[model samples]
Every structure is written in structure tokens, then in C-alpha cells.
Target: MTDSQRTALIDHDVWNGGLFGGADGRWYAADQTRDVIEPATGERLTNIGVARAADVARAAKAAAAAQPAWAALAPRERAAVLRRAAAALERNLEDAARYIARETGGILAKAQLEVAEAATQLHIAAALPLQPQGLLLPSTAGRTSYARRVAHGVVGVISPFNFPLILSMRSVAPALAMGNAVVLKPDPQTPVSGGFLIARAFEEAGLPPGVLQVVPGDADAGAAVVEAPEVRMIAFTGSTAAGRKVGELAGRLLKKVSLELGGKNTLIVLEDADLDVAASNAAFGAFFHQGQICMATGRIVAHRKIAAELTRRLIDKAQTLPVGDPASGTVAIGPLINERQLRGVDAIVRASIEAGAVLEAGGTFERLFYKPTVLSNVQPGMRAFDEEIFGPVAVITPFDSDDEAVELANRTEYGLACAVIGASVARASAIGERLKCGLLHINGQTIADECVNPFGGRGDSGNGGSMGGPADPDEYTQWQWVTVKSTAERTPF
Candidate 1:
């Protein structure tokens, strides 16, 4: 992204002050607007329209009215539309990548990865409707019984700023493929990449009017979506604090809810693990996208035998990671989403150092850019180990035995994801089973995700509602049992 390209993105007038509603098949300027600031440069990117309570209700009503017709389409037809959307995404990949990197302050590589993952998500979701035996089941002697999966009418998708493109698709693509209309409320900080780009792809692919809506705003706008009467399901990805509120509101209304929240994930290196590989994985897990990832490795529990070597390697790795403008070539750490997050990470690093943790390398910050930092001597009570750092800070703590490593890994309140790296795959697999997180990686980084693999978290991380793979539609639909009687003998009603 050159200065001229950045200027063009920042001055783009299409999203300067508009809310998109698939219902009306148009973008409308709102009564109020909010300025979006580029975190890396502290420059005004653009202004976005703020959706009010009434706007959310209108989107919901639009979705509800359009859903039945959408659901009535043959499965193959819906699949075709989804495939077209995927193609559209691919066509817009580079421009979308630029928008994402500029808006989210994520590196160009991470932004490109997000766009590719989103395309994959759309393609994978298209297959849901093509599965021949998905809703079919075995029948008893006198009757034929099966379950048909149906949409939950309207699904409200609320995604975070970090991983905006993929996180939005995790729910949006699946919901649309399953014949559900969507009312999306993206993070206020990233409306363009999160809500606008997605809507544009589907729209250009000829998605029917009212099938998707983008109403971008802050917490108030998100609350409106959650509180809307017509929304039957809510797919949320954010902090545990906000997720809890969404769960509470949805639970009271008996609305289905799926949450992918925070994590204090761990990366374990056993005694026999290769220090080179373990350190490399740790660097990637802890600093990629400046560690804004929900499953970023927060704690590293190394076997005492290899702790010294691994810690030394990790410190060296952090120091070498390029930290600056995300638009630059092959950068590792980028600016955080905002100044608040930058300050928060700074405070955590400072407090952890004061709490007896050793600051090994890279603890400085300039504006929203925080260096990829390494912390050693991290103890159980230290914030660096116990809480989700959500920054480019890797904490290393030595454990004497395998049992101790497991104990330390499971000590945190979150159970989102973790990694165990060792020479023996079987041993690592066994140890992974003993770990408490919902997702685990053996001999690799915890950062990898696939559209065909189930993705979510456990405990404070989520409510066990998963996204992706064959089960993704489960989060956005309901299962109704259908049965037919032979003659009248098997009829119960």
C-alpha cells in the first residue's frame, strides 16, 4: 500500500456515510455517523453510518419477509448462489485485502490470508446444500423417519474487528447457504472490510434482495440486533464480556446463540521436543497479526530440560520480527486495532514485569505499534500468564514434569485452543487429549484453521457452539424430525 493507494482507500466515498440493507437493495445515509480512524497512522479513514434501533428492526423485518422464499429454493440453487459469491470474493481479493489491512492495521500478509480464508469459507459453505445424506437417517420397521434441517428465519451476525473478514464469513456464509437471511452488525472500527466487502460480494453474485443486511455501529447497534424480535439466532465473535451479554439476552428470548470469545491459550513444549521447531511455532502463534487472534498463544509451558534453550531461541525470534507499517513487505507485527488496546497491552506488560516476570525483549511501543515482546519467568499469578494478552507478547514458563505442564496449561479460565509440541506424535496427541481447550494442535502452531474443521472454544471462551466444517449449519438452523406411518398402524397422532 503506497501513499497514493492509502489516500484513495482513506478517501473512498462509497462507504463514507452509508448503511447497507439488502432488504432495500441499496445503501442509505444514516441520521448519524461515526468516523473510522486508521490505527497505524492515526488518520481518518472514513465516516460510517450508525444504525439505530429502528434500523435494526427494519433489517430484521426485511430478513424475515425474504427468508421463506429463499428457503423454498432448491438446495442446489442455493449452493450455486454461494459458489458465485465465492467467485466474486476471489475476483475482489486484492482490493479487499488492501481494505482489510488499512482498516484493521493487520499486516498485508495477514489481510491476504483473511481474504483467502473467507473465500474458502464461502466455497465450503456451498457444499452444505449439495450433501445428499446430511439430513437423512435410518427408519424403523413401520415408518420412515428423518430429520430436515431448516433455517432459524433470521440470523444476526456480530463480528469483531480482528479477523473481521473470516470471522464474519464463519457465520454469514453458513447462514446464507442454509437459507437464512442475515442482519450483520460488524465492529464499528471495521465496517468496510467486515460488513461492506461481504455484502458487496454476495450482492454482485446476485443474492436476492433482503437476504443480507449490513448495519454498522458500536455496542448499541449490536444490542439492537440481539434484542430484535425477528432474529431467531445470533452468531457472535468478540470478548467474553460482550459475548456474555449477547448470550444472556438471547437466552431470555429463547433465541439460538453461538459465541466464539476470548482465550488464554497455551503452547507446550515437552522435554524431547525440537527447540527450533517449538520456538518457531511459538513466534508465529504469539506474534502473527500482532497477536490479535483469539487463540494466540498466551502462555508457553516448556519442559525444564529444554526451557533455557527454547526461551533463548524465542527471545531471539521476537527481537528479529519486523514491527512497523503493515503495508510494508514481510512484516510480522503491525499496529493494534486502536490506542486503547495498545495501552492495555502496554499496561499488562508493565504490570507483569513488576509482578516478577522477566521482560526478555521488545517491550517498547510507538502509537498503536507494540514490539513483538518476549517474557520469561512468568508465574501463575502474573497477568501475562493468566489473562489473554491479545498482543504480540509471548510468555515462557518452565515446568518440571508433563503433569505440571498440563496443570499449568489448564489453570486459566479460558479453554479456547492450545498446542503441544514434542518429538513423538503419539505422546503429544495423548497429552493434547488431557488439555482442556476445544481445539488443539500437536507439533505445530495453534494459529492454523480450516473451513472443513470445526472451530470454536470451551468454558469462558464460548458456549460450545462451533463454526465451520459439516457442523457449521448447526449454529444457524434447527432440526425437525419428520416421520411417515405405514398404512395407519404406526400413526401416533
Candidate 2:
């Protein structure tokens, strides 16, 4: 069927797909369902199935049983599956983008970007199986040795609500390409884009039954997926608090875990930097998707000389950007994921202002919609400066020297991503080297990525695991050294 036709069926309630990727190689309706409320309009978007612990167990069991047969397939054949999936996703890009906007409360442009990123990720993963798998090694006389890479069997993925599509595919595509089955537990808030859309793409691409199981669930169901005996590893994207729980549980179970957690990312503007460019990039970095991204620029450290100009420009720019429903093509900023999140962001911003942060512009909200906000003269102890205010809020703090800027950037517990904007590339590079972060950008926003870059975080942000480029397959598989010998060598004791 054409993409439009299928989406129209979904929009019209004519194609109400189930939630569970069953052990019997088919989708099944759950015992219970929950209403998925649209963040933009505060209305029911659809009713998605909710998986319980039993459902999680069934999915994991199916993944374990299907893994061996999938791994046995020729590498080329496996790669083809991912390629087909990518094609299917691209074909349904518009439909999926609309779903993303409705469910996540993201702007239309951001939703479109997410779809594009997912397609690119899938395409990149499709080449994993075709890449060289082992290395030749010199050995003793009449013996040969080599190191081979193999799948980790069944991988469990627990994704977050923000950027659900790309984050899930970051692990799912790579795991499948590396010859492993996956049990995906997408955030319940974004079931349509996170769960059903992905399942449809894979099914349309003709992926083997039981290779991928998506469970739409909450915290309890997520814990069940992590605790499943059949799951060998877990890839999670969420908050640091949640990451700690997942990491601790996976550590106790001796399962490999890769986490893409929270961040209070910093963006530095040097004295010689272009104020206009800096202001524009800063506004985009802090307000895009209502600043829900883990890598969003939460803190802006500027040199004392240009700090005022940059902050003023940012305040004015933030005030002018339209904020409203995602469907309003002109709006750049949209509502938060839910009412609770809106209230949390509101509280944080208010606390920061009370703690001496100068509210420069836009510090109000209507329902779930928070205005694009800028805070100047923000001090270290303020909630806006110290915490991840996952909303359209940016705080500007002045620093006297390059050393102080680097120090302020490193003060936070997070070391996820940081950016430096300066006239001299050499100076920026030097400062970038001194910052403690997993990803660094010079003359750009804190949030930037490509298919070739190894995307991940450091410190509380993650556990030294990455999800792109050559490192992705490494994270999803195990390396083994195999040696063949013609005869046993004699040893003297």
C-alpha cells in the first residue's frame, strides 16, 4: 500500500494496529490500552496498547528464539533487510513526520528533521554487515589466529519520548545489522511514532518474524525488559536518574548496557566571536524542540566583552520566534511533552529567577506551551544554570577569560556535548581540548551530528558507550579470538 493510504487509514481509525510483537510471529492487542494524548492540542491522538511484565517476557523469549536463525543468514542478506527498511521509512516520511509532531509536540521542521535523521541512520546501519568482520593475525608455526566479531544475541532497547524515532533506530538498526534480535520498549507517550511506525517499516521491508519486538510501556514494563533473562544487552536513552537505575540493574545482571542520558551542555562565545551568528545559533540550540534534547545548549558562557551584546540579541531573537501548535507551519517552538513537564519547566525557570537570574524575555506559558525564554546574569547556584531545564530556556553567564569559560563549562556534572564559538580556530580548538565532554563542536551549535560521528556522552551522561559510525557494531557485538592449529606445540615444564 502507498504511504498516504496507510497513514490515512491510521488517521481515520481504520488501521488500529496492536502493540505487542508476539512470540507467535504476529502483532497482538494487549490486555489493556491507554490513551495517547497529543501535546499540541491536549486531545486524545490514539489509544495504544500497554504491555505488562508478561508481555515483556514473551517479547524477550521470541527475540531469543529468532536470534540464531537471523545470525545464520548471510551478511549480505542481512544488510539487504536494513536497506529495505530504510526505503520503507523514506517512503512514509511525510506521514511519520506528522505523527512525530502530533505525539511529541515538536515543531514541523524538527519533526521532519527527525524523520530524515532516522532514514540516514538506517542507511548507515545497512552497511555494517558488509564491512570487514575480522582481522588476520600472525601466530606460531603451523597455526593461524584471527579475531572475529559476532552479535550479542538479544538486545533490549529502552528509548525516551524526545526524539523517539532517531534514538530507537540508533540502537535497533545497528543491532539488527549485526545479526541480533531486539526487544524495543519505547516511551509510552510517543507510541505511534516510536512503536507502531517502526514496526510497520520493518514489516513492510519483510524482516523475519520475531526479529524485532516493540513493547509500548511505562517504567515497570521497562524494568521488566531489562530484567528479561533472554536479553544480553540494553541500549537506553533517557534522564540521568533513570540511566542510573538502568545502569545499576544491568550491572548487577552482568549485561552490557549503553546509555545516552541527560546533559547540561554548554556553548561558549569568545570576545572575537560573531555576535549575530552566536545569538542565532544559541537561540536555535536552546529553543529547538522546546529544548528537550539531551544535547541542547542549556548554558551559554560568554566573554565579558561581547556578553551583553550576545545576550541582548538572544533575548530579542527568542521573543520573535513563534511558539504554538506544531501544525501551524510558521511556529518554531511548540508545547512540552505533557502538562507535568510544562509545570516542571515553569517551576525551574521561576526558581532560577528567584535565585537572581535576570529574566530577559519570554518567561510565561499557556497550558503546555512555554514561551522561548532567555535569562541573563545567571549565577552558578541558580536552578537554570545548574540543572537541565528541558524547556525553551537559555541562561547567559559572563566569563572574563578563556580559562574561566572552560572552567565554567566543566563545572557541571554532565560531560555530554559542548560548543565553542570564536574567531580563531586554533584558540577554539585549544579550548575545546580542555573541555570535558564526549562531543565537541567549534564554530557551531552544541547540538550537531552525522552518520559518521560516534555519538555518545561521558560522565553521568553515559557509561562510555557510543551508537554511530564503526563503534555502533562494536557496542552491539562481542569480539572473539579463534586459533586453528595443525599440531600441538611441545612445552617443557
Evaluate all candidate structures by whole-model CA lDDT and list the values in order.
0.86, 0.88
My TM-score estimates for the predictions, one after another, are 0.94, 0.96
Per-residue lDDT of 75 in model 1 = 88
lDDT of 2 at 332: 90
Model 1 — which ten-residue stretch has the worst lDDT?
Answer: 1-10
Kindly list the per-residue Cα lDDT of model 1 for residues 1-493, writing each as its tens digit.
2334322222257666888874666777888899888888888878888888888888899989888999898888898888877877786677778778989999898888888889998888898877653465688787788897888899999999999989999899989888899999999899888898887777667788888889987788888999999998999999999999999999999989999999999999999987888899998999988999998999989998888899899888888877777876467778999888988999999999999999989899888889989999999998898889899999999999888899999997899999999989998898899999989988887787888989889999999868889678677778889888757663476
Which candidate gets the maximum TM-score versus the true structure?
2
- Please tell me which predicted candidate would have the highest lDDT against the true structure: 2
Each candidate: RMSD: 3.7, 2.0
Cα error, candidate 1, residue 334 (Å)? 0.7
Query: Residue pairs in steric clash, candidate 2?
Result: none
User: Which regions of candidate 2 are displaced past 4 Å?
Assistant: 1-17, 487-493
Model 1: lDDT equals 0.86
